[model samples]
Target: MTEPRFHGPDFAALEASDPEIAGIVLDELDRQRGGLQLIASENLTSPAGLAAQGSVLTNKYAEGYPGARYYGGCEVVDRAETIAIERAKALFGADHVNVQPHSGASANLAVYAAFAQPGDSVLAMSLPHGGHLTHGATVNFSGRWFTAVPYHVRKDTELIDYDEVRELALVHRPRIIVAGATAYSRELDFAAFRAIADEVGAILWVDAAHFIGLVAGKAIPSPVPYADVVSATTHKVLRGPRGGMLMCRAEHARAVDKAVFPFGQGGPMMHTIAAKAVAFGEAQTESYARYAAQVVANARTLSTSLVDAGMRAVSGGTDTHLILFDLQHLRIDGRTAEARCAAAGITLNKNAIPFDPAPPAVASGIRVGSAAVTTQGFDAEDMNAVGSLVARAVRAEAGTADGDRELAAVKDEVTTLVARKPAYPVI
Candidate 1:
């Protein structure tokens, strides 16, 4: 008989080699199992995605695109990437797709490089007002290398004022206009953005990182029809491995692909691309549409419950899977609320509300998401209970004796509720 073939490094072997890391991984798994994950940008990947991400493809180094790699042994990875590119094109109805970006930020940077020269003016949403860091934050490359002009939501209505967007574009005359948000709960007006960009002769770029999955499932309108280029992360509501993708008109395909390869990053991560293929295929199924619809419904239910518990939800309610609440009325800050909720086995992030008075570290808002919990099978009734728990925890004092008791009590309830549902039942 032939000698037994060596497959790959198994977790069992890893435990023997490095027990410390193995133990930490197990601890993290347990923590995820026992707590409520409400982070708006997080979701559990499917088993197929996980397996693909950890496959033998990780050992390969394909330095270039599928057919024109700088290294050898790329034939198999080339096929995997071709599948990913084709599926992304079908899913988004785009003329071209680039699957080499490492993250959403990288994708945005590539788009900027493709369309605008260094120091050219670019307009995007304000970071404190729901925009992402890559969208012209002062410390980011997009801000440093370009003339970054930011717009904000109206303080009175807590919504994007399209008229103001047009005015800003007319005044600034930016080379590119970016329309997307990280914390805003309303649906974006992509057509309006396109019109404004046209008035200014600017390229409209939509970073739909948070809602690509919803668009794929037809739960929300797509930006592909209006945007000149669109960038998105695969890991959020898309529920894929951690990676990024770019879709654009066929005319700009060469520039975008070149920017991602030689300009923004080195070799593409083939393993992640394979995982993305798995996710894109999964998104084409009927069940994903149901999941997407349920995510939106869960968000609305959670926002309503929070309002019922006397907390003020930003924009009154959500039209997406995210809910941003102003913590000012609760007599607490975002940092305190985040800590208290975490103490009670709930995980979320502090955010800045429109016209927030406090600093970023101690902002006057808390943002919660329903995607992860919905993935774990949470529905409207469960969201009501979660909202109650959040309210109670935020209302509790951090350093007081009674506060400790209230937090402990809420933690017990959260543990009991979450224990009933597993995020990955088959795992």
Candidate 2:
């Protein structure tokens, strides 16, 4: 009989030590390989990046910035952090970069720590109008601590109203004017935002968590030049680890660094920092630029295809990787649509459309994204087919035999499609 292999750095060893957890890991791999991932804020990180995240650096606890550590034995981790900061600075064209924040929300918290007091006013897009919760939802710390001033998209246009934003800024004179969104599908006018912020003497902080990856790839206009500070995620379109990063102008460098280190968080996650460095290096490649361009193209194609399949594309269509679909025409709620898509081997999420009639729990919109599929080597034509499949899935009436047949058919077709270009193609 073969001896139990309880050793390091191998799946066999993990299986021998803990079969239950190992089986779960393998099952998740199988699920990812077998299905379509269309979550707007999600992406498939490279194996190299994953290796860095799973590296021995995880054992080290680097508590401060490079070269200035609270922990004694952080010399090696410091080097990894310095590399990450330099690469992020180069990628985003910012004078300062902090790769310490654990998530985009953490990065935003650091920004608030750096720039404003608890009672200061914060002007950001309203959550129901395509903004992130960190922007100032009532339940979030941002809204609870600060005087939250919300803005909205135009009723007819279904797009951000610059005039309204300017008006709000002028009236509120918020300490920080946030310019970014979580679900909005249009490119932001960072220059316009800068002008507004300057007019009101408010700090222009862009929450680029959803679209920073495209900026890194040079596929979209960067807010780095216009905003006073930009907080972003290393994942999503950026295709790094599940981490947060902040970039800012030179004037705020010290404040930003202090905010990330001693204020917002305690110790730096050195392994994730190293993984972010790997991702930033990869983003500098020409292939990444091409991938970014394809992402937008696929999104536009997918939105158009969904429109053809009787869904109303919010804002007439998308100019970015995300597409928000209003499902009022079909009379199906976003929750139901999300479940239907999942049953058909496609994954997406329920979202609220601008001025949605239904509550958030049963929102009126479904959000789709192209970044993951594009990373999986899917193209415009593939997105078109995906749109058709999504439409069929959403229209199927669950709990009925006809709906079951339709779901089975869609699942079979999805299985065939994903097989052609499986995620993590090697294994």
Candidate 3:
């Protein structure tokens, strides 16, 4: 007699059991399929990643590291996590890897916890000038616990001023200097940052959450060799599940692991770890390298097109997967542009530009990325058309009949284009 095969939960059964949630899920699926997703931080996960995230491993409670789990029945989860660790190490060429942080913020926090005590000084990029909230934003834990000295981009060039960074680091003498950004479009000078850290006797922590995939594919430079610790989210350009990872030099491995486990979070999400393993494996492929290259090319194309259509790409143009453009030239606020573009079926986030006069709520700029669209099979040509649609939508007057007509026309075109390129054809 053969052993019985196990099957997963049926969505039809779920629909019958919880129709409201099921309907909402279906609606969201429809929404994703219908519109463009230009959010710089968002990406569509692979079908294999989706399956791993929804796997039975979610039921497991592996409280400790793989080999020394506090709970029972973790033999398989141990293997999954170990695979994730090894794959990440191979991909990034790190001395050690931690695949358990729940989000990128958590990863950064753990790094901070490992390196600095309360009241220690941290030098990082300012939030309004393209840095992430975890990187010493005033309201965040890093700022609340540690003394945060933020660096800024130059007003004239709208780019990070390494001279100023060195000046600040010398004055503050911070314990850690975080080098990375959330909305910055230019390639960071990681080697310069490392030198500053060395000069200041500070730990160089790089938050590569936005560009890890590019680094992995060699489309951009890696921070692993230059930084003491590097943190990243698996979701962004990595195109994995919504989780975080930390890679570090061998000396910090034990401290980093302790911080992530008993200090930062409880039991690890084994399901997400499984998903991360799948994504890391996928990133190792030749196709992913091509995809990463295309993501940058598409961003450059979109930036040029936006400039041609009357917007200014921040720092002139992009060197990675994102573009930050100011809307002040068009006499438009980021809020109004975001709303109008949403109406026209183009999705993106309002962002604060360098030296932005406008407040964060109604920022002076919009941030666009090529990761999601590239995942959906968009090329440079498609990006040009996307830039045109974005320009037309944002240029429309709000709450007017003419504006409504223009938005409708753009929405129809977006719908037709998006229909031709579905986000998840395997699904």
| Full candidate order by lDDT, most accurate first | 3, 2, 1
| lDDT (Cα, tens digit) per residue for candidate 2, span 232-316 | 9989998999999999999999999999889889988899999999999999999999999999999999999999999999899
Off-target runs (Cα >4 Å) in candidate 1 are 1-9
Compared with the true structure, all predictions reach lDDT values of 0.92, 0.93, 0.93
Q: lDDT (0-100) at residue 77 of candidate 3?
A: 95
Candidate 3 structure quality by residue, lDDT tens digits, 343-396: 999899999998899999999999999999999999878988999999999998
Poorest lDDT segment (10 consecutive residues) of candidate 2:
3-12
Model 1: worst 10 consecutive residues (lDDT sum): 2-11
Worst 10 residues of 3 by lDDT: 2-11
Q: Which candidate, 1 or 2, has the higher lDDT?
A: 2
The runs of at least 3 residues in candidate 3 whose Cα sits more than 4 Å from the true structure, single-residue gaps closed, are: 1-4
Task: Write out the backbone clash pairs for model 1.
Answer: none
TM-score of 2: 0.98
